[model samples]
Every structure is written in C-alpha cells, then in structure tokens.
Target chain A: MTALIDIKDVSHTFATDGGPLHVLDHLNISIEEGGFTAVVGPSGCGKSTLTRLVSGLMKPDEGEVWLHGERVKGPRSTVGMAFQNPVLLEWRTILDNVILPLEIVPNKLSRAERVDRAEFLLGLVGLTGFEDKKPSELSGGMRQRASLCRALVHKPEVLILDEPFGALDAFTREDLWQTMHKVKSEEPFTGLLITHDLRESIFLADQVVVMSGRPAHAQYIMDVPSTGERVIDDLYTPDSAERLNILRHQIQIAQGREPADVEAAQ
Target chain B: MSLKKIAIPTIAVIIFLLLWELLVWANGWPNFVMASPSDLGPAYVRYWDLFLINGWQTLWRTVAGLALAIVFGTALGMIMGFSKVMRDALYPLLVGFNAIPKATVVPIIALMFVGAHDFNTVLIAFMISFFPIAVSVSIGLSTLEPEYRDILRSLGASKMTIFWKIALPKTLPEFFGALKVAVTLAFIGTNLMEIVSPHGRGLGALFDSGRTNSDYPLMFAVLIALAFLGIVLYYVVVVLEKIFAGWAERQET
Candidate 1:
C-alpha cells in the first residue's frame, strides 16, 4: 500500500525560559493509505505534537513531512482534525456547527445542498432531532458527537484525532469508540489518533506506535490483529485483555517505568 | 414570575412620575419656569404636527450617521482584528481620536461643512458613533476561540472565507451591542450639533428657541419627544439584536 503520509527523520524544538527544549527527536514514521493508526505515550511525550506536525499546524525543525507527495507546509483542507475539547461554536446550532466546514470550502455548495449535508451527518451521529439545539444545550457526549460530524462533513482524506474522546467519561468514550468503528466500516479513510488509553489504541488501531517521553521518539511499533468480525463485546474477552497488557508494557518501557509495575496497575 | 417582573418596574415608574407632578403643583411654579405634566401634555398635543416634522428630521440624521458608522467601523475593525501590523499602526491613533470630546468639535465641524446644516449634524453624529463600533468589533474579532480558527485553517479556508464565515459572524453579537450604544450617541450628537449651529428645523433647534424665549412648555415637550425618540430607536436596535443574535443569546443563558 502507498504511504499517504511520510515523516522523514523529523525533529522539533522550542525555545523556553529554561533553555532550548527538544520535543520530538529524529522521528521517522509513515502511515499507509486508509490505515487506522494510534500513537500512544505518557503525558508530555509529544504525541499530540506529532499529530500537529502531520496536520501541518506546526513545522518540524529538521527533515520533512510529505502528504500526498507534497511537502506539508501549512494547513490543508484535505485533512480534518478534532482536539480533546469538542470546541463547538457556541453561537451556532448543532446543524449550523456541522455545516461550518462547508461554509469555508471554496465555491461552497448551495444553501439547500449544505442543509441536506448537515442533516445527513447529524442523523449519522444520532442527533437528527436535536439539530436546532445549541452546543450548551447538549451534554458533553452529544457535543463531542456534533464535533465529530462537523469534522467529517467536508470529507477530508485524513482525520487527525488528538485525544478527541479524552474528556468524556469512560462509558461515553467506549461508546464513541464503537461509533467511530462503525463509521469507519461504512466510510473508511486514513486516521491518525494520539491517545493515552492503551485499550482504546489496541481496540481501534490497525497498528499502534509507542513513543518515549519528551524529546519523544518512536520506541515500538506493533501490529494489531485485524479481527474483522470482532464486535464491542469482544473488548471484555481475556484475549483482548492480554493484547492490552502487552501494549501497556510497551508504553511503560517507553516512559522509563518498569513494565511489571504497569502490569500490576492494570 | 413574568407578571411580577413587569409589575415591579411599572409601579416604580408611575410612582416616580406622580412625585414629580406633585412637586411642581405644590411649588406653584409659573409655567414658564416649570411646566407640570398636565401643561406639557396639552403643549405636546397643540404642537404635535411641528414636533413630528422636526422629530423625523432628527431621526433621519441619527439613522444616517449610525448606518455610515456601522459600515466604516466594521470594515476598519475587521482589518485591525486580523492584521497585527494594522493593529500596531492604527490602534493608538484610533484611541487618541476616540478620546477627544466630540461635542467640543461641533464648531470645527460646522465651520468645515459651511452652508450644509444637515450634513454637519450627520458628520458630528458619525464621529460620535463610529468609535465604539470600531473598538467593540475589533475586540470581538480578536477574541475568537482558537479552536474555531484552527478548524478553518485545517480546512484550507482562504483568508476571505475565514473572515466572512468565522470572524464576521463571531462579531455580530458584539456589533449589535455596540450598535445600540452607537445609535444613542448618534442621537445625542445630532441634537448637540443643532443646539450649537441652530439652522434647520430639528428637536435641538426647537429646544434652543424654547430655552432662549423662555417657552418652558415647548422646551419640556421637545425634551419628552426627544426622550421618546431615543427609547424607540434603542428598542429597534434591541429587536434587531434579538432577531440576529437569537442563537448566541440562548447559548449564553
């Protein structure tokens, strides 16, 4: 499969009061077309920074990032992004928020087309009747769902999720993971997820990349078994627990912690 | 709950007006010195036609000035909001200009636009009203949520697209708020110009003439008429805000 994204020996640093701080060091990775990949690490491990680099929000200090064979210079419409916070526009209704991306795209669709697209996406997210509600009127999970619909409305090639579900409660996070899985099953696209949830990474990702603590570097890359028939119930199985355990151990090593302690905590 | 809210304010206004009327009656002041509410009422009825004409002229001048201020102020504000270079270069100058007492410049304004009384009144009104709009709009545009801008940028939205879709809409609530104040200021500015210049038929001209000749009843009538006009114009802007910013206001509450 062709690589849709290529990060070639990239490094990034920031000038701080203490001194020059290295965030990512000589990172090299490539995401294949239509693959669902997750980057996991400890807090401050620059996982989110990597997502910013790939999405062209920030530039690397060294090397290059190529998207669809072009150098990643600045933000591009071909990528959709969602942050940990839902960040829905408070002044807009749920439907209007979903239609925001369409407003920004060049030669935007007509009002009728835009409304049709918004309604379809809102329905897809189970918010069909709540279209007129404002962001403040919705619960946290519903707000996040609306945000997800907004991100996908423009149909970008790559979806960059920087802990999009991190702020949700456990149940909501799990529910959204399933919702995401179902969405991907129907309309698959390349995704880059930066998350700290070990089980979440193992559950949804086709491959999981572990990173070392800040001055982050890729420490391990493990392929997840693609159980095409696996459903949400499979997450509670012993086999799934074992895979999660192994991934947790890899993360512990990356963070310079004892793997045994991490296993015990789990 | 709604009844109590309305009842309280209505009762307060009635009591206040009654006290004023009683004070004038008890003092037995001459109508020339202080016209009671009864005297003012009859005077208003007698001069209603003339008041309406002058009132309409003042209202038109206020609206024209306010509309021009909105157009120019919104454009300048958007430019200042998005461009750091423009902000740095122009913001201090804007602040300085805003600080000068607009009333003090009435003579200069009249002199500059000699032979055009209505135009001078409009010029003064525009000067008074434009500053708040520019300041409020710039602040609103500058304070957009970072995530919203990020969403637009990630979508490869062009500068114009982002300005119209994100920046402009974000400033509507603030613009309307500033507009409310701007309309009131425009009314005051027009009245002040008429007071100083005293050329055409206007509430201010009527006021100047009444005060000069000790036509206390006419002056009192015009004052009431001006107050009514101000209240009506203010509520008009409020109604517009309720219509355009309905979604945003709901979010706040």
Candidate 2:
C-alpha cells in the first residue's frame, strides 16, 4: 500500500551570517494513511524543519515531498498545524478562533455548518461552554486543547503538531495524551508529532523515529507493539520500560554520548 | 466607568485651579499679568460667543485633519509593514520629515496656501498627526509573531487572507494607542496654523485676538477651552479603544 506522506532523501540548509548552516541531511520518512509518527531527538535536530517541509511551509532543497501521491510545491490546504505557543487570535472567542480556517480554505459548508463543525470539535476537547470566552480567559492547557480543535477543524489530510503540549505541566500533558487518543479514534487524520519527551513518543505514536543531532537524518525507527487500547498505566509496564530503555539508548547514540556501534555489538 | 476614575481627575483639576488662584492672590498680580480661576468665569461669560464659534472651528479642523491622517497613515503603514524594500526606502524620509519642527512648518504652509485658511489648518493637523499613526501601525505589523503567519500559511492561506485575519486584528491595540497620541498632536497642529496665520478662525486665532487687545482673561479662557477640547477628544479615543481591542486588557487569572 502506498504511504499517505513521503519524504525522500530530503536535505536543507540555511544561509546564516556565519556561512551556511546545514540543518537536514538526506532525511527519509514515510507514513501510511491514518498513521501516527512521533519524531524525537537532541535539541535543534531539524525536527521542526521536517514538519515545515511536510506541511509545505518550506521546500526541501534536495528532495521531493509527496502527500497523497501529489508533489507539494507550496502551502497545501489539506495540512493542519499546531505549535507550542497555541497562537490563538486574541480578538476572537474560542469558537470563532476554531472557525478561522474555514473562513480561509474554500468549502461548500454554510456559515451555520462551519459553526456546528467547530462546536463539535470544541465539545470533543471538553470546551463546550467556552464558545464565547476569549483566548485569554482559558487556562494554558485549555488553550492548547482549543488549538488542537482548530487544527482538526479544517479536516485536513495531515496534522503536524510541533510540540503542541510541550508547555503544559506533567499531569496536563498526560491528560492531553489521552485526549489525543480520543481525537485520533474519532477523527483519524494522519499525524506527525515532534517532541523532546521519549515516553510521550512511545505512548502516543504507533511508530517513533529517533533523529541524529543537527544536520539530522532519521537514525532509528521503532515500531510500537500493538496494544488493544493505550492508557497511562501502559507506560509503566515492563514491556513499555524495555521499549523506553532501547529508545533512550538510541537517543544517546544520536546525541553522540555513546558510540554508534555499541547497539550493533549488543 | 467607575466614580473614582471620574472623581479623582476632577478633584485634581479643581485643586490645580485653586493653587493658581492662590498664587495670583498672594503675588498681587494684575489681571494682565495673571488671571486667576475666579477671573476665568467672567472672561468665559464675556466672550462666550467667541468661544463657541472659534472652539467649533478648531474642533472640526482637528477632526477633519485626524480623519485624513488615519486614511493616509494606515495606507503608508501597511505598505511599510508588508514590504521590506518599501520600509527601508520610505522610513528614513518619514523620520526626516517628522523631525522638523511643526511650528516652523506652519508659516511655510501658510505661505504656500496663501489665504486658504481652513485647508492650511487641516493640512497642518494631518501632517503632524500622521507620523505617530504610521509609526505605531508599522511597528505593530513588523513585530507580529511569525508562528501566527505560519499557522495560516500552512493551511494555504493567501497573503491577503493572512493580513485580514491575522495582521489587521493584531495591530489594533497599537493603532488605537497611536490614535490617542495623534489626536493630541492634531490639536497642536490646528492651533499652530491658527496662531501663525490669524485668519479670524479657531481657538488659537481667538487667543491671538485677546493678546492684541490685552484681554488677559479672554486669553486664559481660550487656553482652558483648548484644554477641555483636548480632554474630550482623548476620552473619545479611549472609549473606541475599549470597544474594539478590549481583549488586550484581559487579565490572567
């Protein structure tokens, strides 16, 4: 079966004041339709750059990015994005903020239909009564939830989450992990998450890809063993611990603290 | 609005007026040398007609000039905000023009317009006021968060879409702030033109008339009227700011 998203030998560089800064080096990734992939690595590993390329915000210098078998030349309307800052419009209420994308992307939905759609997602995220509240009125975690609804409101073919929950507290982050599962089970859009948390990657994603430090490429790919339904307790199980251990050791190799051949020798 | 908000400023003004009256009484200054707050009441009643006519003229001139400034400043600001090349080219010229003393420019404008009294007043007001609006708007737009634009761009939003949805709304608080400052500058501009070219119109011309006749009470009354006008216009902007960009004032709980 063909993949819904494909990145082929992609390489990119930035022209900085100090000559060129190479960011991505011959990176390759592919996600099947409805797949959830989490990318984790050392800080500044070009993970965010990868999201930009996949979402068609920027073009790859050396290779092609294919979405649903179509070459992405510019920004695509079928990709949704969320960031660490949430970035909700201060002038708009929660409902209106979620309805923003519909106003931009061409659609046959009526105004009433758009509101209904946004309202449905807001309800799913447990923000039913906050329809009229301004972004400032919501808590940080609640704002992030509203941001998630906005990304999915457009019903995009792919969702790119660039550390959407990175700013939340530990408990809030865990709660959002559950919310993610709920959102996925119902909405079923292809998701690409970039995170610094290893446990977060293993818990939420079906597949976790570890990337090398800057001038990064895909260094390790681990397929999470299928469990019926994931819960917070699943993170503490022996199976989960073993997988986390391996992933952590791979990250050490990626960060250059451990020799590359150590894992191979084992 | 709260009573405290209103009462506090009113009390301050009354105390200020009383202090001025006490100073005049203590120094035994003549009316020509200094008119006390008590003296202002008679002067106001005596030249009430002049105050009405000239004050109306100044108010309209300030408003008209400010409306024009809003139009021209927003256009110029959008250009500077959107295009880096335009910002680089036009910003220096704008700064240079704004740097010149508006008082000196008033006589030059009078010379250029020669008998076009109303137009000169309005033009001066627009010239002095437009700079703040343009500078504030450009600063607001240029400093906008990139992540906001990226959110829309990734969804295939056009430049125009991004501007209407993101740029315009985000710049409103700053725009209103500039407008508050611009309104005061506009009053100064209108008065400058009126005084420089004494065309028998506006509060500044009225003040000039009182000066020539040695009517110190009339002069002080006109100054008070001008202050009252400035205060009223400033509050009008504050109200509009509340209506439009009230979200910026939201408190974190």
Candidate 3:
C-alpha cells in the first residue's frame, strides 16, 4: 500500500557565498497513514529540511516527493505543520490564529463549521478559555498549544512537526506531548516529527529514525518496544531505557561524536 | 503611567521655553534682532488671523498631495515588492530623485508651472513625501519571514492570498511608521514650494514677510504656528497607528 507521504532519493543543495552546501543527500522516508514517525539527528543535521520537503513546501534537487502516490509539484494542502516557535501572527487572537489555515486553504465547510472546528481543536489542546486572548497574552507553551490547534484545525491527512516542543521546559514539553499524542490518536493523522530528544522519540513515535550530520540520510530505524499503547510513564521501564540507549548510540555514531559510545556506556 | 507620559514632555517643554527666554533677556539683544518670550504673546495675538488662514491653506494642500501620493505610492510599492524586475527598474530612478535637492527643484516647478498655485504646491508635497512610504512598504513586503510564508504555501494559498493575508497586514505597521516621517516631509515640501512659488497664505510666506518687515515677534509667532502644526500632524499619524497597527506594539513571542 502507498504511504501517505513518500520521499524518494531526495537530495538538496543550498547555494551560499562560499559554494553549494549539501544539506540532504539521497534521503528516503515513507510515513504510513496514521503512524507517528520521529527523525532524530545532530543539531545542525537536515531533519527540518526533510520536514519541508515532505510537506511540499520545497522541492528536492535530485528526487520527487509523493503524496498519496502522486508526485508533488508544489505545496500541498493535505499537510499541516508546526515548528519550535509557534509563529502565531501577533496581531491575531488565539481563535483567529487557529482559524488561519482554514481561511487560507479552500474547503466546502461553512464559516460556522470552520469556527466550530477551531474551537473544538482549541478545546482539545486545553486552551478553550483563552481563545479570545492575543498571542502576546499567552505563555510560550500556550502559544505552542494554540499553534498545534491551528495545524490540526484544517484536518490535514499528514502533519509535519519540526521540534515543536524543543523550546519548552521539560514539564511543559511532556505535558504538550501528552496533549499532542491524545489529539493525534483521536484524529488519526500521519505525523512526522523532527527532533533530537531521545525520550521524546520513545514516548511519542511508533518508529524512530536516526540521522547523520549534514547531507543527512537515515542511519537507522527503531520500532518502539511498546507499540500497542503508551503513556509517558511507560518510557521509565528498563527495556525502554535500553531502547533509548540503543537509539542514542546510533545517533552519536551518525553524528561522529562517540564511535565507542556503546562500550563506553557499559 | 499614562499621566507620567504626558507630564514629562509637558514639563520639558516648559523648561525649554523658560531657558530660551532667560538666554535672550541676558544677551540683551534688541527686539528687532530677536523676539523675547514676552514679545511672542502680543505677536501671536496680532497675527492670529493670518496664521489661521495660512495654516488652513497649508493643511488642505498637504492633505491633497499626501492623499495622491498614498494612492499611487501604495500601488507602486506593492508592484515593486512583488516583482524583482519592477524593483530593479524603479530603484535607480527613485534614488536619482532623492539625490537631487528638493529645494533646487522647487523654483523650476514654480517657473515652469506658472498660475496653477494648487498644482505646484501639491506636486512638491507629493514629491518629498512619497519615497519614504513607498520604500518602507516595499521593504516590509520583501522581507517577510520565510517560515510564515512556507506555512501559507503549504496550505496551498495563492500568491494574491499570500499578499493580502500575510504581506499587506505585516507591512501596515511599517507603512504607518513611515507616515510619521512622511507628514513632516510634507510640511517641509510645502514650505519649500511656498517660499519660491506663490503660496497664497502659507506659514512659509508669512515667515518670509516677517523677515522682510523686520518683525521679529511675527516671525517667532509663525514659527510657533508651524511647530504646533507639526505636532498636530504627528499626533494624527500616532492615533491612526494605534487604531490600525496597535497589535505591532507588543513584543510577545
């Protein structure tokens, strides 16, 4: 069966004053419909580049991106994205910000239905009372929560999130993880996460793909030990810790920081 | 807090005026050479009618010229902002116009366009003020955050949609900010035109007449009038910004 988003042998080069900088080389990823996948790499690796490529926000120089088995020629409305910074337009109130995607993307839904969906999604993220407040009035976590609602309000088939919780504190990040996961399971959209947090990957994704440094390609993929259902606490187990260690070891090797990391850990 | 915002400026102005009066009195200059603060009150009372008429005329002409510039300038700015070809073609021309001293062009406009007093003044004001507005708007549109734009495009928004929803609203605060500078430029443009050309009752001519008549107090009065006009115009821009672009004031994430 065709995956919801398929990236085939994609490579990208950014022209700089120095020369052409290769960011991704022969990168391939397939996200099955309704499955959550996480991509982890070093800080400067091309994980975010892959996120943009799959969302159809950009073109890969060497390969094509496919959505539902069709080649993506330009940006696609079937994908929704959130970033580390919520990027809510300050002028817009929370409710208006969440309604932004629906306003931009054409749909047969009436304005009332759109508002209803925005409100419903906002409520889902536990931001119901603060809808009337401006983005400036909210905390960072609340702003990110509002951004998540904005992304999901349109009900896109695929969701691309680039380190959306990386800026938050540990507790806020974990809280949002619970909120996001609960919302995703209920809505059942394919999710792609670009992050470096190992425990975050373990708790949230069905599959965690490790990546190399610049000119990034997937180094390894690990199926989460607990596949059926997960709560944040489930990641505290010894087995989950072992899985985290394995993923961490692969990432360190891919990043070329600690080749003997595994043996060193013992 | 708001009271403090008002009181501090008011106190500063009073201190400045008092210091100026003391400096002039201590210098012991003759009244013909300069007017003291005491002389200003009588001078204003004597010339109140002239100031009112000329101030009204300047006000109308400034508004007319500024309105024309706003319409054409906004369209021009958007076109240049969206198209690199348009920006490149117009950039040199705008630079050349800016490089020329507007004062040099004022007399030529007066000599070539004889008898259309309104037209000459309006053109002068338009010429001086439009550059800042157009350039600011173009820059604002051109420099929009790429990440926000990606979000819009990923939603399949059209270029026109991107412009209205993102570019235009984002540019408004900058555009409004430019208007504050543009209003002062409009006053300067009007003064330049009125000095050389036939501005029937502008403050520029009134000040020139005071100079010719050796009426120092009258000159001071007209300067005061012009200063007041500047303050009023500046505040008008401020209030408009509050209504239209207030959201930009907050620095939240």
Candidate 4:
C-alpha cells in the first residue's frame, strides 16, 4: 500500500523558562493508505504532538511531514481530528455540531444533502434520536461519539484521534471501541489514534507504534493480526497477554523505570 | 400561578405611592415644591400628546445613536480582539477617550455645533454609547475556546470566514449585553445634549423649560415620560437579546 502520511525525521522543541524542552526527537513514521494505526506511550511521551503534526496544526522544528505527496505546511482540510475532551460547541445541538465542518465549507454540498449526510453519520454513531440535544445534555461517551460523527462528517482521507475515548468508563470505552470498529468497517479510511490503552491499540489497529518518553521517538512497531472480530474473550489469550506485556514493558523502560521492577509492582 | 410573588411587589408600590400622596397633601406643601400623584395624574393626561412628542424625539435620538454605536463599536472591537497589533495601537486611545467623562464634553459639543441643529446631540449620544459595546465585544471575541480556534484552523477557514462564522456569532450575547447598557447611556447622553443645546424639542429641552419656569407639573411629567421611554427601550433590547441569543441562553441554563 502507498503511504498516505510520511513523517521524516521530525523533531519538535519548545522554549521554556529554565531551558529548551524537547518533545519529539527525529521521529520517523509512515502510515499506509486505509490503515488503522495506534500510537501508544506513557503520559508526556509526545504522542499527542505526533497527531498534531500529522494533522498540520503544528510544524516540526526539523524534518518534513508529507500527506499525499505534499508537504504539510498548515492545517489540512483533508484531515479530521477528535480530542479526548470531545470539545463539542455548547451552543450547538448534536446535529448542528455534527454538521459544523460542512457549514464552514460552503458549497460542498446542497443544504438537503448536508442534512442527509449529518443524519447518516449520526445514525452510524447511534445518535439518531439525540440529534437535537445540546452537548451538555449528553453523557461523556455520547458526546465523544457525537464528536466522532463530526470528525467523519467531512469524509476526510485521514482521521486523527487524540485519545478520543480516554475520558469514558471501561464499559463505555469498550462499547465505543466496537462502535468505532464498526464505523471503520463501513467507511474505511487511514486512521492515526494516539492512546495509552494497550488493549484499544491491539484490538483496533492494523499496526501499533510504541514511543519512548519525552523527546520521544518511535521505539517499536508491532503488527496486530487482522482478526475479523475481537471480543473480550480474545484478551485472555496468551498471545494477547504477551503483546500487552511487550507494550507495558516498553512504556516502563521509556519512563526511566526498570521494566522488571514495574512488572513486579503491577 | 405565582400570584403571591406578583401581589407582594404590587401591593408595596401602591402603599408607597399612597403614603407619598398623603404626606404631600397633609403637609400643605406648595404645588411647585412637591406635586402629589393625584395632581400629577391630571397634568400627565392633559399634556400626554406633548409628552409623547418630546418622548419620541428623545427615543429616536437614543435608538439612532445606539444603532450607530453598534455598527462602529462591534467592528472596531472585533478587529481589536482578533489582532494584537490593532489592540496595541487602538486600545490606549480608546482608554483615553473613555477616561474623559462624556457629560463634561456636552458644552464643548454644543459650542462647536451651535447652529448645526440636532447634530451635536446625536454625536454626543454616539460617543457615550460606543465605548461599552466595543469593550464588551473585544473581551468576548478574545475569550473564545482554543479548541474551536483549532477546529477552524484545521478546516482551512479563511480569516474573514472565521470572523463571520465563529467570532461574530460568539460575540452576539456580549454585544447584546453591552447594548442593554448602551441604550440607557444613550438616553442619558441625549438628554445631556438637549440640556446643553436645546434647539429642537426633546425630553431634556422640556425638562429645562419646566425647571426654568417652575412648571413643577410639567417637570414631573417629563420625568415620568423619560422613565417610561427608558423602560420601553430597555425591554426592546431584552426582547431582541432573547431572540438572537436563545441558543447561548439555553446552554447557560
């Protein structure tokens, strides 16, 4: 498969009162077309920064980020993003929030067509009847689902998720993972998800990229078997546990803790 | 359904007014010194047409000044909010202008446009009402969520598109809030102008004439008219606010 996104030796640093703080250090990554990739790391490991760079919200201090053979200079409309916080506009109803991108992109579709598209996306996310409710009226999981609908409404080539389900409970998070998987199956697109949840990464991704601590660079790339269906039972298998252990170990080592000791503590 | 809530305030006002009328009548005060409600009622009815005519003049000036202020102040405020360079350049000047009491400049305005005929009064009204709107709008636009800004940026929205779609809509509530205050200031400013330069007939001119000739009843009538006009204009803004900002209000509640 051809690369949909290419990050070549990208590094980022921010100036601080004490000194320069390095975030990403010469990170090289490439995402294949129609692939689902998850990036996992401990907190402050620059995982979110990686998504921001791919989405063209921030430029790498050194090196290049290319999307579909073009250098990423600024925000790219072809990319859609959802955050951990859901970030829905409070004043807008769920339907309006889902259709927000279309409102900004005038003449993209007729008014009737836009409404149909918004309804279709809302239905896909199981938010059909809650369309007219404001964000404040919805649960955290529902809000994030609405946000997901919003991100997909524009039908962008690449979807960037920055821990979109991090704020939800375990049951809700599992349910949304399946919902996301179902949505992915219906509308296949290149996805880059930055998350700390190893099970989420293993279950949803075609490939999982692990990163080291701050001044983070790609540390390991693990390919998840293309199993057609994943259930909670699959998580009990020795292979699944091994994969999870590897990721857990990598995170511990990156955070300056001895992996053996961390594992013992756990 | 909530008759008790409504009745308590109504009863209090009636009792207060009755006591005032009794006190004025019992003391045998001069009519010019303090006109009772009974005395003022007939006076108000007799001069209702004149009061309305003057009230209309004041109302027109206040509304016109407010409209002009909304246009200029909202635009300037949005610019200041969106651009640091604009804020740095224009903010201090705005502060300096605001620092000078608008009332103190009425004489200067009158002297400058003595024969200009109603021009100075409208200008003074605009000056006084404009600042609050500009300040409120700037604050509102500047305080938008970073996430929303990010969304716009990622969508490749142009600066003008961002302003019109995001900034302008977000500032509507604050703009209306400032407008509520500006309406009252517009009334005060227009009245001040009329007092300083009484060319055309307005509430302020009526007030000045009544005070000069000791027409206490007429003075009371103008005050009543001013109160009614101010209340009416304020409610108009409130209604518009409810219509325009219904979505935001729903979110708040």
Order the candidate numbers by DockQ, best to worst: 2, 3, 1, 4
Ranking by TM-score: 2, 3, 4, 1
Write candidate 3's Cα lDDT for A119-197 as tens digits.
Answer: 8998888999998899988999999999998888888998889999999999999998889777976777888998879
- DockQ values for all predictions? 0.52, 0.83, 0.76, 0.50
Residue A86 displacement in candidate 4 (angstroms):
3.1
Candidate 3 stretches greater than 4 Å from native = A225-229, A261-266, B1-15, B72-96, B251-253
CA-lDDT, candidates in order = 0.85, 0.93, 0.86, 0.86
B-chain TM-score, every candidate? 0.91, 0.96, 0.93, 0.88
- Cα displacement (Å) at residue B65, model 3: 2.8
Candidate No. with top DockQ? 2
lDDT of 4: 0.86
Instruction: Assess the local accuracy of residue B36 in candidate 1 as a C-alpha lDDT between 0 and 100.
Output: 74
- Stretches of candidate 1 exceeding 4 Å from the true structure: A14-22, A42-45, A89-93, A102-120, A132-136, A229-266, B1-15, B26-34, B251-253
- Clashes per model (N, Cα, C within 3 A): 0, 0, 0, 0
**Share of reference contacts kept by candidate 2:** 0.91
| Candidate 4 clashes between residue pairs 3 or more apart in a chain or in different chains | none
Stronger candidate by DockQ (2 vs 4): 2
A246 Cα displacement, candidate 2 (Å): 2.2
Please give the TM-score of chain B in predicted model 3.
0.93
Models 1 onward score TM values of 0.87, 0.96, 0.92, 0.89
User: Taking candidate 1, what TM-score does its chain B reach relative to the real chain B?
Assistant: 0.91
